[model samples]
Target: MRAGWTWLAAPELWPGRRTAGEVVLALVLGIMAAGSEELLGGEGPRLAVVGIAAVVLSLLRRRMPGTVLAVTAALTPLLSGFAPLLMLVGWSAGRRIVGAGRALAMFSVAFVLFAGVTLQDSWSQQAPMTRLLLTTLYFLATTVVPGLASRYWTQRRTLLHALQERNAQLLWERELVAGQARLRERQRIAQDMHDSLGHQLALISVHTGALEVDPELTPRQREAVGVLRGASVTAMHELREVVGILRDGVEAPAPVDDSGLVGRGTAGIVGLVESARTAGNTVELRSAGEERPLAAAADHAAYRIVQEALTNAYKHAPGASISVELRYEPDSFVVEIVSAAAPAPAPGEVVSGGQGLTGLRERARLVGGMVHAGPADGGGFRVAGVLPYGVVEAAPFVAAEDDFRQQSPKAATVNGLPPMDWTVSARELAGGKERSRAGGIAMGCGIGVALVLVLVVAGGFALAFLVGSMSQGMIDPGEYESVKIGSGEDVVRDRLPNGDTITLMGLDGKGPKEPEGSECLVLMSSDVGDSFETEPVFRFCFKGGKLIEKKSYEVSR
Candidate 1:
């Protein structure tokens, strides 16, 4: 099996060329473990050299990590931090075999061992016990922290590579599909225009030829005929261009490629407003917060989101008073387009029934961004999107689209299908960047959560130590004080000082005498009594070498 899968599983071909580095790290860890015996306990050099030899061989972990790991583990028993060496070797081997998850498990074992060693080292010291415990814990934590971190990094890199691979695959697939779609669209356009415009042109030509044959026509009539002929020729040329678009498909004559970090953001969105205003629609453009750099993907997505929103406003609700807003929030950028319903445009006034909103939604989804469109409480359409600040690579698939309106007279954005120059490309919008940044933020937060859990566990252990060991002869210094308090006027008379809560009791997985807790439950009761009384008593105590009881209060109907 090893020989058969040798090529498939070769470590040299692992992503990012990291096999060599991993091997070196494994070896270093092994040698360190080997040398620790001499430095820590003044042991003989024989065991040390053996360890070094094992380590030297352990460098092969990347290619044959399991074998190297086994050898090192068997050789390093007497060395200091031997567990760490074993763990690193495990990771070196495991990461090559399983994934980051298994490597992490190996790292966890090493981390626990380091903590145990630190705890043992910190005992019998002159410092206060609490101080000793804390220092020891932190020291152990720091010792193991690197291992834990490496585990995460290994996982993170592996996951990232997986993401990139998936992304690459997706991108390849999208391009392939986009190519086919462009071709299909071209074909559809060709069929449509040929059937419609082609017949019209043929008719126009026949009409002009008839006029030419009619010699009895007067000079004015002849001039009119000439005008008709000219119009027909012009129409034919226009139709031919349309057909050319379909036949030529997305292969634009000119090429374009560049990250267009140079494009306008606010100004670009503003243009849509100006165009709308010129068309008799009322618009207000509002900007907020300082502008920041965004990657190409986000910038373009933002622009498209706004453009489509504005287009929808004009097409479906012409003359609507529209407000366009761009705001910078804590972790994201925001774009909002709001407009009043100007009454559905008289059929002729509206060019489209409503495809803009649908289109924008699709755009948002691509970046894992979101778009919310609905009628406002005040009356009008509201389109809002939250996006990331940066990471919008200025290149998008639309760059290659021939159908995209040319940004300038002399140049245009190019797409996949043998299109124009690669010099200029569109950037993704701010919202896309925001979402991606948000995803990264979430990842950091997740790791932080793990750290928090570690701290919590350490704290609980600290607390347990305090509880079990700290005490005066009769009482702890900071025990809860006995005090007098009053209840609020609205307090229910039927209830006691404590609420009626239920605790769920099951046999718990352990046998009948299990020492654990089951789930909890809650219960409520109506007014059992209308008045409060301080008559009930229940208490027990055992701190001062004696038992004590205290009176309690209750309310009864």
Candidate 2:
């Protein structure tokens, strides 16, 4: 019941649904039609019936556009006020009508009705030719032009709706794909941590176990060895638990809560280099500037950088010499690992899958850092990264918010996603220059359109003025009145300076000029004519440059 009520209340959901405004418009159209008929001395039963029918049918235009349009067009000749109702019906048909053939047929019917009614009403007052021309022009302007404009508007609305729907679908699909990719990436990270760090812990346990059983060591040293082995085993167990949670897509507890993992932060950074040296590799480790503790994320990123670099070296370079350099600046930590190219593996060397560097890059980005890993200039490979002390998590999709901001018009003047200050900072840091160029291009296009419109309007006004001047040229009635059969043609030419001559055809058609090949001129009043009655026009004929004849006759309008 509530759903039905909601559906009825929302007129926007259905195009044909009548709202309060539509009802008001129908009533107003009916009243205006009736009032216009009364004002035009057409107050009678027929007038009242036509007015009522027009109002009632207009209200149903959305549901029956063609029928309403035909009825309105039929009544337009009787009630000039019905023209508005007819135009409204035409607009509705253009917007709501489906097939082009049907729309054309309906428009044809309306055109015929309008032309017939208009011709019948104007036939008595206007000549048949005039009535026909006027009827055709009126039908084109009132019916064809408005229909075409409304059709174009409807097409644009449909296109906009389609684009919006496609955009929404694409956004939904993108979000789903991103979620899946994020899950897979998190799982991969968990597995990489287990494989790399777990191996280190296992080695520690094995070496400590071997030392614990030695007889040469004192009781204190043996006890310390046992404690170290026990700690390594315990760490391995905790690592497994964390990896399990990651694989299940659950949020792992905070690093500290999960046995102080982040607190141990960059402790593994130096061990990574030492471990490589212990494993029969010629590796040199150097540090410049004072070493200071970093933020949790930055410290973790630093440890991962060294770990992945060494892992890559051990797999690809094998016995090649490697150099690891760490530079601690005032506000950042930089790590670089450079290794010489390696020879072909003798046998049983681990093959590289290129996953270590991928993980390293991900880690660096998460900690507001950048990583570069590629072949170096001197026939070696370099893996370098820079980690800032105060790290911020890089947003996964920073540009997407800009699109949302543009499409959404809700509370647009106020910042919705973030305050203007933050938005400005983000845009500047994330290619604001490119967006500025786009905005400049858009603004330029708008200015060009405005300039073109102004030019077109000015040109139209100038053309109208030129035509008016050419149409009403200078005419001399006194000189024409004095001209007789004995006058010279030169005197007549001097009287009328401005060139104003037209073919003296019958009522704007060809009639006759006295004597074949003789020069003839027609002179008439310059004042604008108001009545339809024919006016007298003076005709002059000149033979051998001498005015020979003059006559006057009425020219039919």
* lDDT score for residue 39 of model 1: 64
How does each model score on lDDT?
0.54, 0.67
Model 2 weakest lDDT span, ten residues long: 409-418
**Clash counts for the predictions, in order:** 48, 3
Q: Flag regions of model 2 displaced more than 4 Å.
A: 1-18, 44-51, 121-126, 174-200, 213-216, 223-227, 234-242, 254-557
User: Please, what are the lDDT tens digits per residue for candidate 1 over residues 416-490?
Assistant: 332222223222111244665686677657755765577688878877765443221112112212411232222
- C-alpha lDDT of residue 126 in model 1: 22
lDDT value for model 1: 0.54
Candidate 2, residue 216: the lDDT equals: 99
Superposed Cα deviation of residue 231, candidate 1 (Å): 2.9
Q: Model 2, range 241-293, lDDT digits (tens) per residue?
A: 67887788663533342334443356555655655766668999888999887
Candidate 1: C-alpha RMSD after superposition: 24.3
Q: What TM-score quantifies how close candidate 1 is to the native fold? A: 0.37
Candidates' RMSD to native? 24.3, 13.1
Each prediction's TM-score versus the true structure: 0.37, 0.49
lDDT of 1 at 433: 49
